[model samples]
Target chain A: AQSVTQPDIHITVSEGASLELRCNYSYGATPYLFWYVQSPGQGLQLLLKYFSGDTLVQGIKGFEAEFKRSQSSFNLRKPSVHWSDAAEYFCARIDSGYSTLTFGKGTMLLVSP
Target chain B: DVKVTQSSRYLVKRTGEKVFLECVQDMDHENMFWYRQDPGLGLRLIYFSYDVKMKEKGDIPEGYSVSREKKERFSLILESASTNQTSMYLCASSGGQAYSNQPQHFGDGTRLSIL
Candidate 1:
């Protein structure tokens, strides 16, 4: 079975600082990867996705993620994170056979002024 | 934009009572899914339907049943509500192709409490 792992449980970063959230997946083959953000009391919104093309995929809200096949990892990065970027981040991979998504435990991001 | 609407934002029901949570999508998607979210645990799939009257069990299907009489609407039913079932329920929809790599659209979610 495919699984996603997010190592950090909570991360606090100062505003305007660079941000990177780690994600690792265990799968036999290259699977579609995605990043999603969820604000308090709201549903999750897609940040970005990696299908096949370039390893580096850009997403909404000035965010981007790079897929590294060798490490079996896809990490999300932002040059400068705003206060509004504080939320719970989740990394997911598409189930090869079922077309469903398997998500990570999630990392809570806190922006400090 | 794809719109997935869950009927209630919050619901309170008594233990052992029958509970129903409704979801509807406007994108005419062929795949609809139900998941539960809890602290320290990410979303866990409860059930999913690819077509009307076609339902598949997800990772956690115990004490839960689903109904998909219409293509756009999917309902999750709790046979007998329990406090352990108190959690946030989310609904999602995806494209028609079963194996296609389409992203799923999510709703605001319904917070259900069984007391």
Candidate 2:
């Protein structure tokens, strides 16, 4: 079975500091990878996605994710974190022959000033 | 912008009561899905519909059912609500194409509680 794993349950970073959230997947080939953010009481917002080419993909809100086939990882990163960036981040993938996305357990980000 | 709308943002129900959760999409998407979100479970797919009157069982489909009577509307039914059924239900929609990837659009979600 295909699955997504987010090792870090929670991460805290200072404002203006760099942030990286790790994600690993259990699959044979590189499936469609995605990063989504969910604010308190809000639905998920797509940050970035990786399909076929370009290992490094840029997304909205200054977010970027690198899809590493060799590592079986699609990690999300941001250069400078703002206080408003505190939210839950989820890594998702659409495995082969699946129409729905399989999501990770999610990483809760806490921005400290 | 693609918009997926759930009928409720919060709901409270009693045990063994039948419950209905409605979802509507304005993007004219060909695919619709229902997922339940738990604190540590992330999101688990409950059901999916590719077209009207067509449904597919997802990862967790027990104690639940679905209805897709219209192209823009999909409903998830809890035949007998239980205390363990309390969860945040999410509705999503996406365009369908063979071998093509389309990102799903999500609604705000409905937080359902069974007592």
The DockQ scores of all candidates, in the order shown, are: 0.72, 0.59
Q: Candidate 2's residue-wise lDDT over B1-115, tens digit each? A: 9999999999999999999999999988989999999998899999998889999999999999999999999999999999999999999899975234688889999999999
Q: Where's the lowest-lDDT run of ten residues in candidate 2 chain B?
A: B96-105
Give the best candidate by TM-score.
Answer: 1
Docking class of 1: medium
Specify the highest-lDDT model's number.
Answer: 1
DockQ of 1: 0.72
Report the number of the highest-DockQ candidate: 1
Residue pairs of candidate 1 with colliding backbone atoms:
none
What is the C-alpha lDDT profile of model 1 across B1-115, one tens digit per residue? 9999999999999999999999999999999999999999899999998888999999999999999999999999999999999999999999857766689889999999999
Q: Tell me the tens digit of each residue's lDDT in model 2 across A57-84.
A: 9999999999888889999999999999
Residue B23 of model 2, lDDT score = 97
